[model samples]
Target: MPEAKREAWITGVGIVSTLGEGADAHWQKLSAAQPGADTTTFAPFVVHPLAPLNFDAQIPKKGDQRQMENWQRIGTYAAGLALDSAGVKGKPELLSQMDMIVAAGGGERDLNVDATILNGYTQAANPAAFLNERLMGDLRPTLFLAQLSNLLAGNISIVHGVTGSSRTFMGEEAAGVDAVRIALSRITAGQSDIALVGGAHNGERPEMLMLYEFAGQCLKDKFAPIWERGDKGGFALGSLGAFLVIEARDHAEKRGAKPLARLSAVVADRASRKPGTITETLGKLWDKIKDKVKGGQTAILSGATGSTQATAEERAFLEQHGELAVRATATYLGHGMEPQFAMNVALATVALAHGSLYPPSDQTGLEKPMSGSLDQVVVTGVGHWRGEGMALVERVG
Candidate 1:
């Protein structure tokens, strides 16, 4: 499949996080720099790495949060907004024909919280007492049917009455992109008319942060705020949710939905095990798909995770695929948080649709090639991506 044959488009957007309650608010604050790294205590072990880092959270209005688990609340909240933006209004017909493919990169369940609640509920002898304890916050639902890891997909399917396909995938960060790639394949092959593709995560869980730290995935620095923390933490923890409505060009046009950008290609190669293998892997992916992103309205939407390793990998891709002058926007959208990679891809889809590129955060000091060859958004929230950085990269041959 050469880059010349790939095709897909982004027709909607949605987000819910600390940055803002809805997509527009979230995007506005995300586009600007602020105090994003102030740490907050979630549970005993859970330490929120940054202020806006837990963008998956919302300021529960009045009495809205006590009924749902944290994950369910956030996933449902964000997906609903995304569907609305995509013009999906709980239509039974559209949903039954559409697919729901949601992916995440980390543990979907808050293990620490689960253990605490399950222990309490199991020990209570009186069912009424146990129920009362649960209501009183002492014995939580051990079988919190709402918080199952795959609830994102399940809830989306139920909310929209989607009967086509409902499942979740958990893998490496690159897995988020893989989910979209799979969706594109199904749609292009004429298996479906519309696909609801999204990524999300609630970053407030302690166990999740521990995993990140254990893997040496924490931001490299200790900067404190969105304005000042740019140097300390390579990227602060920030909540993010993104969804895109992808349909065949003809179908989109017939439905009168605005087309943001067409999907070109999303290529992933095994990360090299060696110190410099990332560079080589990136180069290979670029070489394999450069033709797809070449020509009119083409640009690279880098998966800039801010980790030195991730940065190096993407940097190598730019060097080899420099003809189009790549650009990055993650630091602008904030950290992907819990469902790390899924949220990143969701945001990337939006970035592609709007053609707005975000500059790397000041924390990592992602410099424009000293030669200024690659056109990048080096400042905070530069409006819509100027020109078409969203290129239909040539497919891998």
Candidate 2:
């Protein structure tokens, strides 16, 4: 006979965003429908900046903090939070065996260097050689090393001592989906007993804004709630980090770890993103997890990036399942790209543990309120351009 699949539970979550740090602070701010976006700083393009964090609290060594870029520091700090939440911090035995999966974007660009090169290149006698000289002379060697996507995972392992196998995925929002999907798959398939999975995005950067602006994906001018963005849809970049400690139920039980929520299923799909592709892809994903959902007791935590077609199609899909309560978190947190889906899953676990969904903040009438007790949360990720995914997070009882 074949061995039965092991159950997977989300035992710990570490999250830091514009709303604040940790589960309690987020729950409190979200419960009050308070948003933490900054409209003036990156004006014209709205952004949700990271809340003030003291790196010393999680990363003790000043040298370690200085070595990493802001996003890496954010992710490493969140990973430490997850380890602490899982009661594994300082437990070298557990840390040594814990596997890690991280979803990350290319590291932050050195804008000053970029600007200097751009400004001087056209004026030089030999533009190519001038550019080459600036690239070779002005940029520090350590800057290139710090920009590697895997460095976030490396820093986490170094500072937190999580020395197990490490994997990093990069594909914008899709990376976050796959990171959690793979981690859950490993645990349920009995290949992994315990794992830390998540991602971080530092969207408060000039290069990021410029790149997305080229695609016309940055929410500009006035900041509005996600659903209200209409045809002028664009994502308001967010700076945030999220990490979760997920383990096989038996493994968690043996360690006396308390589960915050059970992660029953995670499904992902890539659509060509033609006119109606998102809706079609999401319908197929919803069908796969619908059987595990109890109509009235279930709700949705959407990772809608507020991009024009993507948000609209995801909204259409949710409208078909109107019986379920829905909240598009990007309205509050903005969109953290690589970390968006992981952050939503963390929020879903938090909502399940609290037994209540935060009140609706959208004036668009799309985010209706829920009355009864909350038991299940279907977290949805319809990537701004390419990926669609869903995961069912339910109360552990």
Candidate 3:
């Protein structure tokens, strides 16, 4: 990696998850080691549901809220919170020029329409024609528009008044890594001064659970902390929204914005999942940022999703760095797919700001406590299927 001309600082963070909304609530609840997973509602498959939220707080217009899907609303509310935390909300001068990068999944399925089609298709004399007819007749045109992945960025722009350039990435967990990586790189390379980057996941939908279930990738029957999920480990889906306002250090200083943490280095890779590739990819990413690490003061915030192979491979890599205190955040937040990396990065920033690591939530002895003052954090993100990324977030000044 070439030397950066500027420094990147995380000036603001906004997140809503099973614990609640905002950084303080997350910190307090995570510190207490509480996991908000609900196993019975979805039965067999476990999930961490989003806490009760009044969308009116962040999105005032009922019409605007009505048009967006639950995922879009969750993301828009989080974006508004990030702007608020940065003290730039409603400030037309700044809002008009702030760039945005969002990691998102395709539009949500209209279950009612999908079910109606599925039920009628099997009984029809001509299945293909019947399917096409139902798709054309029963599905509204607006539903197709709503399924567009880029709509999250559009909704955020409409709701938060962010009018700068916008880009959206769509590859599940990998998307979150690249969103932050590109934002940080742009600020460092002088392509942009400030940016809003993150994503959201709504894991409570029956479609999502059914989809993952078909692939045998979801935790079923009971919810255990990530580390103890056993050999056939699977992820417990979680509903969450995470956004971070990262700005060039000088740009923030010029605007009188305070820094929450310094975003030092971000490295991402899509390792072909052939046996040991994930471990090798993670190691290479670690080598890129390992030199900046301070021995005892640095802790790791892992985005391990509790999937069998992925989580185990990440554990192998972590074993090599046993000197650092490690905490697998999925134990509490569960896995939020597209937003998991951003949430872990936000949690790391929150921990760095407080100068301490949150208590470990695992029982396998894989997660250890940190007694010394925290200064730097190395975040690891291994997607449930394909991507691998690592970022170094440190205490600023």
Query: How does residue 313 of candidate 3 score in lDDT?
Result: 93
User: How many collisions per candidate?
Assistant: 31, 0, 2
Tell me the tens digit of each residue's lDDT in model 2 across 1-397. Answer: 1222999999999999998899998999999986657888888899999999998999999999999999999999999898899999999999999999999998998888888999999799999999889989988898988889999999999999999999999999999999999998999888999999998999899889989999999999888889889998799999999999999999999989999999988899999999999999999998888877898999999999999999999999999988988998988888999989999999999999899999998888888999989999999998888898899999988
In model 2, what is the error at residue 353, expressed in angstroms? 1.0
Q: Candidate 1's error at 198, in angstroms?
A: 1.5
For model 3, residues 49-100, the per-residue Cα lDDT tens digits are 9999989999999999988899999999999999999988998788888999
Model 1 is weakest, by summed lDDT over 10 consecutive residues, at 379-388
Report lDDT per candidate: 0.50, 0.92, 0.92
Clashes by residue pair, model 3: 44-221, 107-147
* Per-residue lDDT of candidate 1, residues 50-141 (tens digit): 22323233323423344445555566566666666767657676667777777654335646656766677777788568756665674345
lDDT of 1 at 180: 67
Winner on TM-score between 1 and 3 is: 3
Q: Which of candidates 1 and 2 is the stronger one according to lDDT? A: 2
The lowest-lDDT stretch of 10 consecutive residues in candidate 2 is: 1-10
Candidate 1 TM-score over all chains jointly:
0.71
Which residue runs of candidate 2 sit more than 4 Å off their true CA positions? 1-4
